[model samples]
Target: MMAFYFSRLVEIFPFFLRGLWMTTKVAFCSLIICTLIGFILGMLRSSNIVFLKRLIGTYVAFARGTPFVVQIFIVFFIFPEWGLQLEAFPAALLAMAIMGSAFICEIVAGGINAVHNGQWEAASSSGLTKLQQLRLVIIPQAMKVIVPPLVGQYVLLIKDTSVVSVIGVMELTRVGWVTVVRIPEGLMVFALVGILYFSISYPLILLSNYLERRMAI
Candidate 1:
């Protein structure tokens, strides 16, 4: 079986690599959209206005509470009823971004809030407007707090990309499933898949640790 499988490994190698590439692409696209939307949501989250805060709160809560697959199905199938049509890839990307952004927003807001009131007072005394304080004073300092958690979120997003493959996104998990089915070795297939994810995720965790250390945290 070992000799026979050695031959099959060569056959499996190329498809596995292709699947990894596709998974990376989906994760990258989702991260960009999520970060952009999250910045907006984060800013809104810290606003003094109650209505704006509540509006963002409702969105964050719902997006976080529901499962991503459920969101994906809803966006792909349900939106057409409201004249909002989206294909599978776009729909999946949209749902992933929204779910990620909600979490990112909370992370950012928490960081901002951590910057004590004294910091805000000092910035205000220096004639910094609210916008200026946020841009120059608050955000830069808050970034020290946010960076570690944000890195964790990014790793999570990479793993979560595996879920999108349920919609036929051709990501890493889908590719592994295809390989496993062909091999007739459930354990071997899943074991290889786990190794592949570990290979991707471990480096990210190391990077996060490095950044935290550099921050002296």
Candidate 2:
């Protein structure tokens, strides 16, 4: 039975393979972009600057609270009147970055907060500048706490590549949908999609567990 299924999959293999490649590209690109955005927003939110914190807080709040689909629509359609126009792929990528970044930023801030205050006080007493304290002391310890969440965020970002395909970005899920339209094997196609997502995420989950153990958190 499995052989027969593999034969059928082989028949439709190119479409799925193309889809897989697109998924990889989208996920990898978006992950890198989201990482930068997340780190910046995370740092800004933790900044001692008052107004900057509130502004960053509002952005994070809206990104976190709203539905991702709405964000995609707003950026792709509604923002056009303001003379900002992005093609489907860039728009989808932006949406993914924005949504994922907000979550990542929160994860970072949470990790930072988890560090004991005494560490900061001790660093300050040692005459360390804020940048020096962060670079030398707080960041290293916060990093251990942050890894599990950041890894989980990366997995989530990869999973999110599917949602962007809804806007016709021709990534994995979009390719799957197109193939299913031709083949009319919705269950098989979707099942394969689930398998692909699981294959990537499960390994990350294991790695996260290992890091958590090593960090002793």
Candidate 3:
């Protein structure tokens, strides 16, 4: 039976590949969205402005404090009542964006804050506008501190794609669950799922390590 199920898993491997593609798309799109929003919010978060900082703080707190699954449910199930009807894929992406951006925001804020205050004062003395200071002087330096953990967060985001399966996203983990129903080989099915996940995340892990070393210089 084990041999038969193993062969069955091999036979349906294409199904898993399709699921892998979906996961990739979700992760890629979410990464872009998270990075953009995270950077913007992070800049605001590290800013001296009291209202913007507190407002973003509240959002970051809520996002970090809540379970991701609950966030998905709220996006997928609750939003319809508010007259925002989103399909599963869009809803999954939205939930991912919200959750991911918050974490990334904190990472960006930490990175920006790590820059010496003298650097900011120097930039100001150079007569660069605030935006120019961040773009030209601050962010460039912060990238060294930011890139490693940011890559690490990306790995976590990719793995978190599995949670979207609860909203019917048909991602890799969802494929594994469906395959288990047919193959009735829970261990075999999920083991393959785990391998696929590793394949996706492992590259980012390598890149993170490389960035850590390179950035350390």
Candidate 4:
């Protein structure tokens, strides 16, 4: 029976490939959006402007505190009540962007905060404008602290793509669920799902480790 199911899976391999492609598309687009938004919010969170700092902090706290699945539900189901209609794929991407940016924001904020006070002082004393200080001095130094965890967060983001399946986006995990119903082989179906996820995430895991080591040196 297992052999027969395995053959069936092989025959439908292209279906899995399609799901993988969808997952890749979501992950890539969301990561890019997250990184940009996160860096901006992070810089704001790290700023001396009290109102901006507090406001961004509240947003980050809310985003980080809630479960991502709940967030997805809100985006998919609730927003329409407020007159924002979204399809499943866009909602999934929106959820990913919202959740991922909160995490990446903290990573960037922490990296910025980790830089010594003296560095900021030096930049200021050199007559660099606030933007120039960040652009020319602070952020470059902060990247060493940021890159490792940012890569790791990317792995988490990739896995979180699975959760978006709840909204019917037909990514890899959704494909696995649909296949299992037909194949009646949970282990085989999900094992392939796991392998696909690993294939996507493992290189990122390696890159994170490499960055950690290199940054530590």
Candidate 5:
């Protein structure tokens, strides 16, 4: 029976590939959105503007404070009652965007803050506007502080894609769940799932390590 199930898994390998594809799509899209929003929010949070800082701080607190799966459920289940109906895929992306951006926001804000105030003062003395200062001076200096942890956060976000399986997003974990029912071999099915996840995450892990080493230098 083990051999039979193993063979069955082999035959349905393509299905897993499809799930992998979906997982990739979700992870990629969410990462892009998260990075962009996180940077903007991070920059604003790091700014001297008190109101923007407070507003973003509240948002960050909510997103970081709550469990991700609970956030996913709120987006998928609760929003419909408020007349916002989203399909599973979009809902997954929304939840990811919310959670990922909050974490990245903190990372970026911390990075920006790590840059000495003298850098900002020097940039200002050079007649650079706030935006110009960030673009030409602050952000570049902060990149060393930011890139490693940002990449590490990306790996976490990618793994978090599996949580969207709870919403029927048909990602790798979902594929494993469905397969296990038919194959009746939980370990084998999920080992395959884990391997697929590792394949995607391992490269990012390597990149994160590389960035950390480079940053430390």
Candidate 6:
């Protein structure tokens, strides 16, 4: 039975590949959008401006406090009542961006805050504007603290793509679930799903570890 199921899976491999491609596209696009928004919000959160800090803090808090599945439901189901319509893919990406940016925002904020006050003073003493100080001196230093965890966060985000399958995005997890119904081999179907996810995430795991070691030294 296992051999038969395996053969069945192999025959349908291209379908799985299509699902994997969809997952990759969503993850990659979300990562880019999250990184940009997170960095900007992080910088603002780390700044002396009280209002901006509080505003972004509220957003991060709300995002972190909620369950991702709930967030996805809200985006997909609730938004249309508010006259904002979105297809499955865009809704999934929006959910990913919102959730990912909040976490990444915290990471970036923590990294910036980790840099010493002395570094800031030194840059200011050199007559560099605040923007120049962050650009030339601070962010460069913060990246060392940021990169390792950022990579790890990326792995989490990739795995989180599975949750987006709940919205009918036809991603890898959804594909596996659909296949299991047809193949009647839950273990085999999902095991292939696990392998595919690992194939995508394991390299990032290694890179995260490498960055940790490199940054520590």
Residues 1-217 of candidate 1: C-alpha lDDT, one tens digit per residue: 8667657966778887888888788889999999888877898798788998999999999988999889888877888899989876787788788899999999999989888889999999999998998999999999998888898899999999888888787777898787777777767767777788889889999999998898864
Estimate TM-scores for all models.
0.92, 0.91, 0.98, 0.98, 0.98, 0.97
lDDT of 1: 0.86
lDDT of 5 by residue, 1-217 (tens): 8999899999999999999999999999999999999999999999999999999999999999999999999999999999999999999999999999999999999999999999999999999998999999999999999999999999999999999999899989999999888999999999999999999999999999998998999
Better of 1 and 4 by lDDT: 4
- Backbone clash pairs for candidate 6 read none
Report the lDDT tens digits of candidate 4 across residue range 129-210: 9999999999999999999999999999999999999999999999999999999999999999999999999999999999
Name the 10 consecutive residues with the lowest summed lDDT in model 4.
53-62
The digit string of per-residue lDDT tens for model 6 on 47-87 reads 99999999999999999999999999999999999998999
User: Which residue pairs of candidate 3 clash?
Assistant: none
Worst 10 residues of 6 by lDDT: 1-10
Model 3 spans > 4 angstroms off: none
lDDT of 3 at 15: 99
Question: What is the alpha-carbon lDDT for the whole of candidate 4?
Answer: 0.96
- Considering summed lDDT, which 10 consecutive residues are worst modelled in model 5? 175-184
> lDDT tens digits, residues 75-161, model 3?
998999999999999999999999999999999999999999999999999999999999999999998899999999999999999
Q: Write the per-residue lDDT of candidate 2 for residues 1-217, one digit (tens) a residue.
A: 5566556776977777777788888888888888888877777777678998888789889998998888988988887889889999888888988888889889887777788999999999999998899889988988988887788788878887888876788777887788776656677878887887788788988887887788884
Q: Give the clash count for each candidate.
A: 0, 0, 0, 0, 0, 0
